[model samples]
Target chain A: MSRQQRHDARVPIALAVLGWLAVAFFVLPIMALVLRVPWSSLSDVITDDATTEALTLSVFTSVITTVLAIVLGVPLAWLLARSNIPGRQFIRALCTLSMVLPPVVAGVALLASLGRRGVVGEILDDWFGVRLPFTMPAVVIAQLFVAMPFLVLTVESGFARSAGTVEEAARTLGASPWYVFTRVTLPATQPAIVAGAVLTWARALGEFGATITFAGNFPGTTRTLPIATYLALESDIDDALLISMVMVVISVVILVALRGRWVGAIGGMR
Target chain B: MGWRNWGYEVSLSIDVKRRIGATQLNVQFTVAIGETVAIVGPNGAGKTSLLRVVAGLISADEGRISWDGMVWDDASSGEFSPPEQRPLAYVFQDYALIEHLTVGDNVAFGLRARGVRRRRARERAQEVLDVVGGSDLVERMPSSLSGGEAQTVAIARALATEPTVMLFDEPFAALDASARAHARRLFSSMRSLSMARLIVTHDAVEALTLADRIVVVESGSVVQIGTPSEVLATPRSHFVAEILGLNPLSGQLRGDELSLGAMSLTVGAHGVDDGEVIAIVRPRSVSLHRERPEGSPRNVWRTTVEAVDRSDGRVRVQLGAPLPIAVEVTPAGFDALATELDGDVWASVKASEIVVQPA
Candidate 1:
């Protein structure tokens, strides 16, 4: 053996053994779930009224939440990435801080700001006779509050890495400011945007803590798939696993279809 | 040479001041319609900065740019026209074609920006592409094009705009020698067009070959402006002299004698009393000999060969010590001399061949 190889081989083997043990420790739980799948009664478990309603509600709310994130979040991403406004770093940090917060804290924070007796909610109720808490829209609001940060941060990094010179060349060719943004800037960063939308949709679908704390668990009103999974755990554990399995399947399909290249491109941005 | 016999009227006047770090650019010049002006200058002498200011890539500190009674920039009132609104076409050094677009779409970009229909824009773009000899490249992507093909598409895109004025900043700089010849032919065709042209280049050949007039700049200022012949026969500054392939020597003038440091030379004169004068002589004007020639040439010096560099099928022999000079000799003449490194030689030059300019 070469001298350097022999020198490196002098190190103990315990750490390598411990590293593989750690990998097995992390992979073992997913293996256990797949092993005990309860496959025969899966369809019967999922077709029940509460299960179907929660499943459909998740697909509905998450899709709507993702659409809202794109409509509202892309402009904010562009502003954060391109504008020379002062204290932009601080503003960006504030956005990141909210994403890292516990979901229960986000739910409580949303309730304090928009609940019936809350600060803005009281004025809103007095003036417009409108209420937001414990409603279906409240679930969407909670999910959006927790999920939009993923979209905003991802799209912002894409815009940051885009070539600003192409935009200048476009303007010199007589393209207006808005046309350049839509034609040059937006298309150049489409991969990040697609990856971000998928991430946001997935996060909204799996949102449980904020939705439960703020929107509550009424039967057909606010119970989403994750909420249904939580309620089913107390009575029927098999039904809960069936709904969880559906969630896992749908997430895998969406990720596999969108995951080939977008994730790899944004890998450098991270 | 003195702005005499000019047939065209001035259409563009740029009188602007800008500061980039320690260098301050303060230039004032004009371009005539139906005439092409080439800017030749040393690197970092504000040649590209002058074009960028005119193109509105950067704003100037003071002054204004006026073209045919239209005000482009007036700094005192903070009035400025952005690059998009100007009716000038700029072909950048790298072409800057958008990578995601097809060649036809890239050329059609300007037309589409003005609300032209997509089908009609591509048709118009195709017509111009044919003029530049790149009609077959319309269906190709910009990333797949060679340097010369991209340059042709860039010029085609600019031509589609039908601009009133045009600016090209070293358009041939990115191409190979063979490609440059093709680009040169395409550029010479632009002479028939009525648009005002200002081309910035460091190569004297491009200026003399393509430009109707040349403007020489130094240290962010316009040092001289003249036709190609005038610039060659009499360069006003040493920088322009060196750029035109001439060796320049400056000294004090006293009656018929030009005193350069410890050396003096007799000159035939229609003369001034006494002042600083610069005499420039091309390499072809100096002739080399093994011993002092038996002719009546006024300037002759015995020297040793320092270096011999060959280019363009000719040898440039560098003579050493006491006014070291370069002499361009033909291949047959070089064979006759059989010049070698560190060899002794005598150089001779006629007094009438020197160009003297007041400093």
Candidate 2:
């Protein structure tokens, strides 16, 4: 064989080894959790009330938060991606700030702006008879704030990639602006939207610091799975390990089912 | 002001301004109802911009466009209709088929967007597909279509909208030779569908054969407007001549003879001075002979063949040294002359066939 052909064959082999090494590094913690869990005490931990309540609240609030993100963030995404509005760069940077901010920092920012003695919270208590801190709504709001940037960033990138020619063709063919958006623009960005939703839902499910800081741990209302697992780890290690396994198992199942779709959407964008 | 007698016509003179760059398309022309006018120019010649202005896709910063006695855009009065309100259909260069939708759904998109019933939209899509000779391609996805099939579906989609004005921007630019011929034939055979048809192309053959009138644009302005025969017969500018494949020679004229790059040719009655002048001669007009034929033609020179390249069914032979002239001849003509490689030849042209214009 020629020298160039031998070099090409060796390069791919080296890359494959590096890729497998990275996968093994990521899987180490999950493998440890599986190895350390006690099989005999699994049934007892499953019957515990705190475990079930945290799982239920986590599912309920994460789904609600994702819906809120879709309702509020899609328009912003469209604007950032497609329009020539003034100060667009600054607005885009501001929107992406939440994605990189620590969850605890996000929780603190939310508290300063929406706590009882804070900006809008004081007026809400006085005029609307409402208290927001340490409540279920607070949990939902914190999750929404931290997770919405994921959806907006994904969808905005999608819009940027779609060629403007198709939209112009739609307009010249007697489609109104709204009609064009609903028909051509929306369908083109659908895969991005779905992928963003999946990522945001997963992030919200695993959220911890923001939920605890903004909405304190309560038995049935505010304590989601991550908070419950932390509290159980402090008092009962067996129960905490079992609850951790449940989180790992559920997330693994979801990721496995969605692997093909995720890869397809990401590859299509490229 | 008369409505019944006059048909749909577009008269536009456009000037647009933007921050990055600007286009001042000060073009004034008319397209009679049911007549096909082709806009031909190089890239960045503002052909698509002019079409966009007519289609109401973008408002001109200055000037006006009137259609059938109705004002579509008037800068002085700030009157402009949105694109959706215009009676136009535009076929983009990419075809722009919706990827997620099936071919039938993509074609039916405009009808559905206009509030037609779903079943009626499907029936209309089928009917339009039949017109474009693509009836069997309805159920397939757009991702599965070949370039030609997708373009046919795009044209069918445009036709389904029942528009008065049809605009196509470089629709054949992406197609291969065979596909381009098919598109050209399909476009030429379409009749009585739209009130006005405007196609923007850079291909000379497309402009010559498809248009009743050809408008040549260069540097965002119209340089010439005439029938294809007239333009090809007497090109107004160098760009136009180059696009139409006419050989342009620049030199000086004294009395009846013209002096060019190391060669001399005779002219007609008119005489030009030592000032710069452009001499245009069609490739088909120059005849190559192995021997200098005894003739009354004013221009005959002894030359040698340097190189030859075949294009389509014709061979373009380049003459050597003193006059580097390129002449086109059919394969049969070349064979009949017993043309040899790098051999001595005689080039003859009539004085009346050469056009000399001031540079």
Candidate 1's clash total is: 0
True contacts kept of 1: 0.51
Listed per prediction, chain B TM-scores read: 0.70, 0.68
The digit string of per-residue lDDT tens for model 1 on A105-133 reads 98888889999988998888999998998
Q: What is the TM-score of chain B in candidate 1?
A: 0.70
Per-residue lDDT for B20-111 in model 1, tens only? 77678899888877788999888788888888888887888999997776788889988888878888888888888887889999999988
The alpha-carbon RMSD over the true interface for every model, in angstroms, is 1.2, 1.0
Kindly report which residue stretches of model 2 are placed more than 4 angstroms away from their true locations once superposed: A1-25, A257-270, B6-23, B243-359
Q: List, in the given order, the native-contact fraction of each candidate.
A: 0.51, 0.92
TM-scores of all predicted structures:
0.79, 0.80
- Residue A19 C-alpha lDDT in model 1: 85
How good is model 2 by TM-score?
0.80
**Best by TM-score, which number?**
2
Worst 10 residues of 1 chain A by lDDT: A261-270
Error of 2 at B237 (Å): 1.3
Q: Which regions of candidate 1 are displaced past 4 Å? A: A1-19, A260-270, B1-10, B234-239, B246-359
